[model samples]
Target chain A: MSDVIKLAHGDGGKFTNELIKNLFYRHFRNRKLEEGIDAATFSVNEGRMAFTTDSFVVKPIFFYGGDIGKLAVCGSINDLAVSGAKPLYLSASFIIEEGFPIDKLEAIVRSMGDTCTRAGVNIITGDTKVVEKGSVDGIFINTSGVGIIESNYKMKTIESGDQIIVTGTIGEHGTAIAIQRYDIKVKGNFKSDCNPLNGITENIQDLYPYIKIMKDPTRGGLVTILNELAELAGLGVRLIEEKIPVSREVKAMNEMLGLDPLYMACEGRMVLVVNKLYAEKVLNRIRSLEGCKDANIIGNFDQEASLKVYIENYLGGKRILNTLEGAMLPRIC
Target chain B: MSDVIKLAHGDGGKFTNELIKNLFYRHFRNRKLEEGIDAATFSVNEGRMAFTTDSFVVKPIFFYGGDIGKLAVCGSINDLAVSGAKPLYLSASFIIEEGFPIDKLEAIVRSMGDTCTRAGVNIITGDTKVVEKGSVDGIFINTSGVGIIESNYKMKTIESGDQIIVTGTIGEHGTAIAIQRYDIKVKGNFKSDCNPLNGITENIQDLYPYIKIMKDPTRGGLVTILNELAELAGLGVRLIEEKIPVSREVKAMNEMLGLDPLYMACEGRMVLVVNKLYAEKVLNRIRSLEGCKDANIIGNFDQEASLKVYIENYLGGKRILNTLEGAMLPRIC
Candidate 1:
């Protein structure tokens, strides 16, 4: 009824009900959600399922490629996707500052609805709360999702010749956020790669037998995930520096900012470890998918070396890559 | 390693891993959680399941009876409990402000762990993010939970003469929050009724055949829920003013503050609609449980009256009760 949110909107009374019906219900309409009062009920077959959650507090709410609402949906979806499950349902919770514009809230909810529709996931249950102004910057969202695991998919142990493949060029999301956060002006077009990766996961569902592990290179980026995998598997990762794909725009921007693209974040990229025999096939399959033309087998695991990760230059020089040691960028995801 | 949270702790790298291992993993440890990398995966039988989520931003994070952490767990658990489901697993996500003391965070996490253990639910997966100081108040948590629906439970339609019952005294939680928030100095003891209601749900679970519906009188309180049920069921609620149970402390606090206990909140109470034939039995069962000694049959549905909710005084004077329309409390949870 008001132009902006009020304390009464979060009082769990008349205004809260009005907001849910006029805004959330209008956008996130689904059978399960319509019947839900306290909780959404649905039937699931007997199987293994994945559950995960993430809270989005990205500054500036709106960004080059997507807003916090889209990020919230994609972030949780990606988490379930990487865990070898097909995401099914999501629960969205919001904490908004009093006086936040109603139009902006509607826009964010619209984006979330659109994203979930594209990913074929339903937001089954949700909650909203309005804190006093200044208690929160503007708004924060938390999305928790559940997904059914593919019956054929199983995590395999890493072997001596396992190869690591990155689904796309790295660091687009981190660069986009940094540019906006630091008030840096950019010349050419640049945006975050903030799309859902469930499409890639679905396409590669048949290759689960060859996949040892899969992870989204999100907040910690490419190098960090490689370091984690190397340590987890107790093997060394030998990467070909030139083989890792990097977009020209992201590379130029990171160079100007004195940052490493390898350590920067990517919102919609996957790091997959596959047996050497099927690594090339997986890379080719990924490259055939949309937005994955740069997918490449950038490295391989070494059996003789200790747990470490390093990239070798074409000229024969090498540098060790550690788990991200500093706060290069905050809330990039 | 720092005394307070830093940007690096949320960077999803080494420090983040250390925080997860030393704190979250230590407190919320379980087989499913330990194996979780990006998401927690588990097996479930074929059946209907309930899913829900809530974000807790209750101010003064530490409260009279319980902390925000405990409230968050119980809030989500109660939602599922009232939905006729047995809660199974939960996901806890935190958005903390930078510079907040680590010890304070550990205390909150410990409270959450203890609450979940008592409720017989496991926190299988979680995520943590730290925002810059001043961006968020201090800390906010979102918990999403899933539960298995009991096969025999069915929501019977509310009919004429259906009885209304409340499982505890009303308004204790809202009164406690008001006192702490307004810095009221009172002589007698006062504490929030913030316990989980799963025990009560389990105790009366065998009477599913005669139960019409169940709802937690949380933020909007008893009067608001009655109004909603009357409108939804196309019947009138005839409440006997003297029959509604109220604690002496809450009654005195509301009277002093010029607030009506009927419209105040309760964190650990359930309002049940049951067939007249079984209402007395259900009330007796509820009264036998822990913390439910105040259970009472407060009213009954009127078939001849129009859809409305009203209270009848001892002199037979009637007053219409409406859904809560004003902002009486914020973040009462």
Candidate 2:
């Protein structure tokens, strides 16, 4: 009932009940959640299910394009989507600092609700914990999701000539957060690319057979995932430096900040490894999807056993791309 | 590779990979987890499933009996167990403050792995994030669990004559944490009653037909849960004070601290609402299990339309037991 959160709100008493009933229940209402006392029960068919969890602790709760709420929902949803599963139910747990404004909390909850609705997923069960002032920065959210895996989708084996394609331009999210965190005044529209990728993934369902693996480049961005893929496949990556998609604004901002776009994060983009035979078709299909106008074939797995990732320029100069080493940016989710 | 966790460890790059492979993978080794990339995929039968989540920010990460790792796993397991489900899989996410010692994190992870191994559940997928030093106190853990609901168990409707039973003694957990937090000098083996309740729940499966509902009295303890059940069933609760189970040490600690045992928390206990005809049988069955010697039928739903909870002493003295109000103990979990 207070304007800001109190320690009593997490005491599992009247205040806790009020907060749950008024804010969480009111926003995340569903049949399973309403009937649930301790856990939400639902029926699942005989099939494979995907489960994943992520926590968002970005420095500024509200950012240029999205807030922590949207990021939390999209992060988990994207994980399941990239794993070839249709996102279904999610559990949200929050650790809130005492004295946080009720309005701010409501706004965050509203954002999560809106995103879930847009993504066609439900927040079935959740828990809330409030700590003393200064114990936590402001609020941190952890979302775990369950999704039913499609039977037709299976990760194909990677080969020497497998092509790598990116769904969109890189580094928008990390650049926006970096600018905001450093309080650097920028001119152009520099906002996070934090959108749900389920739409794009579902649209490219027909290409599942030709796709070896798909990953959402979130933290440690494009180059980091490329390194992971190269290591996993026991092969080397050959990137055409000019083929990598980077928006002009993101490129300029990274130049100004002296940060590599390759290591920066992206919230709503996918990196897909496709069979060489269908690589062009997959690129065309992804480019037709909304928000994927810049889709392109960035590189291909080399036939070498080096187990390294590198970029080659037009003049044939090659440079190794290492996995992100130390902390480039903290709390840049 | 340092003595303490660095922001780079959460960067989702080389250091993050090393942390996962060396620490997380080594402890939480399972087929599904080892094969998982973005999400863990598993098969499920055609049945109802239970899902739950909890975040543990308990102060004094290491308590008299257990640490935060054990608490986090047990808290989520108990939630699913009380819902008449067999706990199966869990996802763990951690938010650690920079400068926290690596050995402590490993100890916590080892405790979690040990608990999950004992409870027969798997930590299939997880995420780790490290914030700036002052952003968080030390560490916080969030665990979300999924379990399959047993086909034979169904929640029967509550009636006025239903009986209420507790599986073990109350207030041990809260009392133990209070003593540790406030540094109260007492001459007794004061420790938290933090243990997984699945063992007891599984042992009492034969009595599921007569069980109306089950709840773990974790935060607000027995009285708070009684109030909730009374409100839900639209009936009053008449608790027999002498019939309730309380450990001698817990009683002594509460008396010295001037805290009400009725409002204290218990971690490894269950408050079951059962049919009156089988209440005695349920009590006997629970008493025969491990660590449940104190099981007793403490109260029964009153044959009144008034929705309230009260206690009746042996002398016929009665007092209303309202839901807990305000902050009693912060971060007691």
Candidate 3:
């Protein structure tokens, strides 16, 4: 056992087996992962299942709030959870650079195991491949998740008179990663907002019938996601700028960095579109949850207007917001 | 729309959406992928299911017989297939280096879509991430497959007295990749035997009752796999070297390069451990197929011997083979 990953670890040989047994299997211990077979087998309930994948190329493997491990688990599971499915199983694959530290790898893997445990999901099967030292920067993780959607828990799409909800404070993840990557001097406990939404997804199922759409705005952030949703629903969205929650620290960082918090990624937050009548109920339920105290009703889409997003300012001025064009931030999630 | 990938392509903005719509959607051409949601939801039958994932980082993206794209598709599908599951759906995640050519990406993607078409599987959902030029090599593909296994079609594991049958010639894939990467001269055509095994898995259900264990010999090749299977099953294996099939070109290349064909990789090959009584019947069935034309009974394990692999040579001499340690080849798959 070397201290750093070597090419032999990915050669589909003895070393690879030991790495899987020691690191991945030790952390994500379960019957399927313990099998160490070519694939994992499990009996899934008959129903519509959500299938999604997200690659974690976050620059610094370890950020303030979470590392790539937690991000990988939460990102993939959230996709399924937000889609109104009970996040069940996940397959993780890692592409590691030669000479990467084994200790760091173990820490990342343990973080993933802890996340999966809290989320009540399993990392059933996985693959590990080590490339030349320079071929990859450090390590990249790709997680794909599968979840069964009970018919009773299916969430529908948004319509006119729907109310929008931002689950928590915005831009924390982007702010955290930026400080780590850019070395920003000022920092006041602004770590990433990365976590599994299974908590909210499970509790909100009580009102699932009234829920329209649920999405976690990760990459292009809240503004861009709202624009996409508006276009898809063929409506205009009006947002109360003040109601959009951005922590004082995150706002200060965003202002100083000349970055829009609306366009900043939040790994663990979800935007919910619910029937206006039940919006308050959904918000109250989410607000009582562990990671969603800041949940609030933002605004609703206008059925009359075209596909556009308008944000009303504190001074009573309204401005049009458009979809993100160029890449704003890379490898933030 | 640009000729080369820009950082914005993975920025989760306008460019990322366009790249996915144009390249992935145009090639995969499926309704689920077209849904363009956070995750794809499909109804699957209730049963024991198989899930597997693999990441492809082969150098020289394109080589004889197949490119990385084809390898990604077949490799993932083959895992489920070898597990005796009907390959159903796959989610592909790509990590492409910035500035990679658009045409090449399109070709690789089209190859993937085409492979899915031939394999009768769909690329339901996928994620695309682009990193800085130096962060990764040309491109890497991570595919996770979900397949449904009926009660009858489920494959079993190896048992002593079970016969070992190889689907086709060995070392062709490793040899083909080597010649392309190392610029080896004086070589006959040595193309990789890369392909999906869904066809065989589906058609072999009738014999599933007798199929003890089936595994695709990829990296670390046949010898290493035999060593693994022997230890896992707690039995001893004896292979007849003269009976094992190897193309003359591959054999010559292995000799010239001081590599063992038994340990050379194969993308589309499988090692089946079946009831010795039905071994011949299964080999004949596989031999009648296109890719499995060279399928043959290579050897069997002895019930009473220790966990070791003994390969009988052309001169009736036998030698013990051990597990693979250091990497003989890196990034070959």
Candidate 3: where are CA atoms >4 Å away?
A151-157, B151-159, B303-305
Question: Model 3 over residues B151-254: C-alpha lDDT tens digits?
Answer: 38544667778999998888888888888888887647889989888887777778888888888888988998888889888899999998899999899888
Over 4 Å off in model 1, which ranges? Answer: none
**What is the alpha-carbon RMSD of candidate 3 to the true structure?**
1.4
- Candidate 2's residue-wise lDDT over B1-333, tens digit each? 788999888888777878888888889889888885899988999899999999999998989888899999999999999999999999999999989999999999999999999999999999999998988889999999999997477877789989999998888888889999998887888888899999988888888999999999988888889898898888999999999998788888898888888888888889999999999999999999999999999999996637889899999998998886775688988
True contacts kept of each: 0.90, 0.92, 0.87
Writing each residue's lDDT as its tens digit, candidate 2 over A1-333 gives 899999999988888888988998888877777775788888999899999999999879899999999999999999999999999999999999999999999999989989999999999999889999999999999999999997467887789999999999999899989999999987998889998888988888888989999999888899888888888898999999999999898898898888999999999999999999999999999999999999999999997738889999999999998875686798987
> Chain A alone, TM-score for each of the models?
0.97, 0.97, 0.97
Q: Summing lDDT over every window of 10 consecutive residues in candidate 3 chain A, give the lowest-scoring window.
A: A150-159
Error of 3 at A38 (Å): 1.1
Poorest lDDT segment (10 consecutive residues) of candidate 1 chain A: A324-333
TM-score for each of the candidates: 0.98, 0.98, 0.98
TM-scores of chain B, in order? 0.97, 0.97, 0.97
Which residue pairs come into collision in candidate 3?
A: none
